[model samples]
Target: MLTCVTRGLFIQLVFDCRRLRKMQPQQPGYSSSRAYLELIADLPWQKVSEERELDLRAAKESLDRDHYGLTKVKQRIIEYLAVRKLKPDARGPVLCFVGPPGVGKTSLATSIAKALNRKFIRISLGGVKDEADIRGHRRTYIGSMPGRLIDGLKRVSVNNPVMLLDEIDKTGSDVRGDPASALLEVLDPEQNKTFNDHYLNVPFDLSKVVFVATANRMQPIPPALLDRMEVIELPGYTPEEKLKIAMKHLLPRVLEQHGLSSAYLQIPEAVVKLIIERYTREAGVRNLERNLAALARAAAVKVAELDSTLRLGKEMQPITTTLLDSRLADGGEVEMEVIPMGQDISNTYENPSPMIVDEAMLEKVLGPPRFDDREAADRVSSPGVSVGLVWTSFGGEVQFVEATAMAGKGDLHLTGQLGDVIKESAQLALTWVRARSADLNLSPTSDINILESRDIHIHFPAGAVPKDGPSAGVTLVTSLVSLFSNRKVRADTAMTGEMTLRGLVLPVGGVKDKVLAAHRYGIKRVILPERNLKDLAEIPAPILAGIEILLVKRIEEVLGHAFENGFPLRLHSSL
Candidate 1:
């Protein structure tokens, strides 16, 4: 059955199909025309999932039930639901969850659908480079179908289901066209009311559909497309958060999925802590969850083997037959009978013991610890090496900058898949250090520049992985200072900031992620630009409590905080 709008279109098409009487079923365009008609008939023009009354308390409970932590994100979701409850017809801004993988971005969108009692559909836009993927190819093209939106509506048989455009940042532009541009109309509240698809050849009413999107980063999303949505940033989980999630959500769920119970497979809290610290180093609990699942699988295999052995033993149990003398005496007939020993049978079977996950077991199943916190201390033990923090798509990571000097034409060499911004920052750091060589007491003689007689080479390890950004500015300078002074920076300290040619430090982005990275690496102290103190408020108090944060406004202060012995300036200097 078609709605009024579609019914009218169907009638018009029927009138135009009089030529079909002259054409055979095997004629050109016959199948496509027939498929188009079937699609029109099948589409849910007005059908909708009967939305249940919005219960804010129940919605909050649902969100909390499925996810742990994410207090800010949960609050934002509650507010969005509240707005929907207050004005059901209001055109609310599309919510776009931006976060690293395994941070529950997709699951939260699913929860919203459950809360609203709306049918849920996920349209994965990752690696979708063609515009046809969004708007559909024109009907003139053979084998064309409707866009993802229309096709999804047909699938759910609803005009107002909660639709998730997942991985929105992964879309790209090419000669075919930009899918992001096509999404502009679909996401825009004012324009989506009449969403047009090329194959459909008619505008579909998408105003009732509730759209939610997710992305790993916001930079790739078009500004115009991004403007139509409200972005909620979900940061990576702390160790404490990951532990709670593992114990409360991941473990039980994994065990049940593997057809085993905690009684059959036990993972102690200490073992889990070890997994978090040694086995995996990540911003999210995805790896942790996978490890837990692996343990569960191993335990399941053992349990299954035990069960099969018990079943084989039962099948092989010997039975002793005896003559029925009572029957022979009473009825004058003899019969052979097997005597059943109920109590004895119970004694022959024993319940299988649960498999416990321990450190040794972890090593066996997960191999040696993939990451070590002590690595930072060992790497920074020598002079000309310092730690810096930078953010990546996976989350924040600890970056080590190593600098050395050798005899050459005083040219600077930089390695490690660095970008232009970082290369420039390195040059700026070098220039700043060279200008302050005399004040820093680094000149061999009063008139000799530090780099005049030797070339400098700076290398960031993890050379295969691309590294960039200005946050490593101070780290580079500190490394150079350590190289010249032959004094090591504190192994326990890591710093991030942008430096100027005048020996001033500037604030940078991803301060929270950097701090988290430091925490993950067991770095006790972090040197951050003074301007980023406000950003620290977003970090959990527990994480901040464990690590000491030093805020600095200038490169001098950064150097002072970075080294165990203060970076002193000479009384007299060459200006």
Candidate 2:
């Protein structure tokens, strides 16, 4: 019996030893988890206590370390956090930063992440169309994984990372189902706490995450989704802003990035400003950054091309803006605008030092301006055509609305991709004009018959873009009235407001952008809603300085500003 028992015990012991060998790898301090731990260690996850969590004040100081202006944006961030603190939840709502690309949206996000005591992660959602992208794909037949949010959570190994959803509006939707719909649950305050992943089949608290989204156009955003976000507008940087950014941060970094230090190269302020206004035409400094990068690359390439020649010569000469211009001169001969930046020495070389990029060279590199406000300057006179200030997704634009009476059926013809509201506006204008036709002392009943039978075609340019909104009513009325009356609209003026059938000019929104657009068009006079006058302080001083802004309480003022003499109806005499 003892021998039999010993044999059984020996067999069990061999089995137990095999199990122990397998279990060793699963231990807390074992190799696999330890490997993950080591990975966390090697990363820049930890720093000296001295450089630890920066307060908002310190972060602001550091931000000033780079960007010179954008004080408003800095103030806005502080205000946002203050408002968030008073909210019911500790976590703040998502902030959607809307603006043209390159105006520092991503950088600002990074800055905010640093300002707050949080980790940062940016997930680009440009072409994300699948619902599975935001909500984890179910794990069944094949290898499935968690959504981007969950994956990002795993990456930072923390619940609260400042997550930037880049290009949220640009994300696509098709038969796969709108990925945006899945995000509704994630973005919603109440439901996000118990957000469940399909693969994990476990509820994860994502509420701690500070979410941010960026977009070029705010309109394309799903209305339901947009409601969850607190939007911040990052307007395109002005020429001055770009100039400041280039001088403060971009030029120095790009110099070192190309293996050229400040001691070796001197990029002039005029050269920087030239690049901002000429080479980069964005509301942001991103393109400025790209061109700067390109210029550096070109310089490096030339430096290499001339390297062999330099070896045969004596000393290296620093490149100046003038030297740069001369080297890159289109005529093939160096111009005086370019100069050398290095210590003066006898230098022998086959080729001159490359340019810092001249105005002409900038055109070749960055191409011509994508837009022109010159249309505003194109014409000085119009018989009936007038500049109507219209608001758009980009900003305010001055639209030319022309009206003419043609021999056709009394049916009114309208062109331009106008929406339902705009079409109604056109109709409303006709009604208002028809009622006042007799007051204008028209060709009596005979002219009224001709006017009724005549067809009027209205059009808005850039037909590819869909146009809507009721603010163009006053312009439509002025155009139609001018067309019928053969009166001229003021060439230097532009106007925007909604007109009620009662002839009251209702105040309109987007007043600031509209005024800027008008100013861009070289408009010396602007007819805006009187109620909007209170908002004038928001308009930039540079724009308001050049233009004569007139607020109107009635459509009478609009008509007064539009015509040199007056609307024919108003000009009617008591002879």
Candidate number achieving the greatest lDDT relative to the actual structure:
1
Sliding window of 10 residues with minimal summed lDDT for model 2: 42-51
Worst 10 residues of 1 by lDDT: 319-328
Backbone clashes for every candidate come to: 0, 14
Candidate 1 at 363: error in angstroms? 1.5
**Model 2 ranges with Cα > 4 A deviation:** 1-54, 66-69, 80-89, 141-143, 171-175, 249-304, 311-374, 440-450, 571-575
lDDT of 2: 0.70
Q: Which residue pairs in candidate 1 have backbone atoms (N, alpha carbon, C) closer than 3 angstroms, thus clashing?
A: none
The C-alpha TM-scores of every prediction are 0.93, 0.74
C-alpha RMSD for every candidate: 3.7, 11.9
> What is the lDDT, from 0 to 100, of the residue 362 in candidate 2?
57
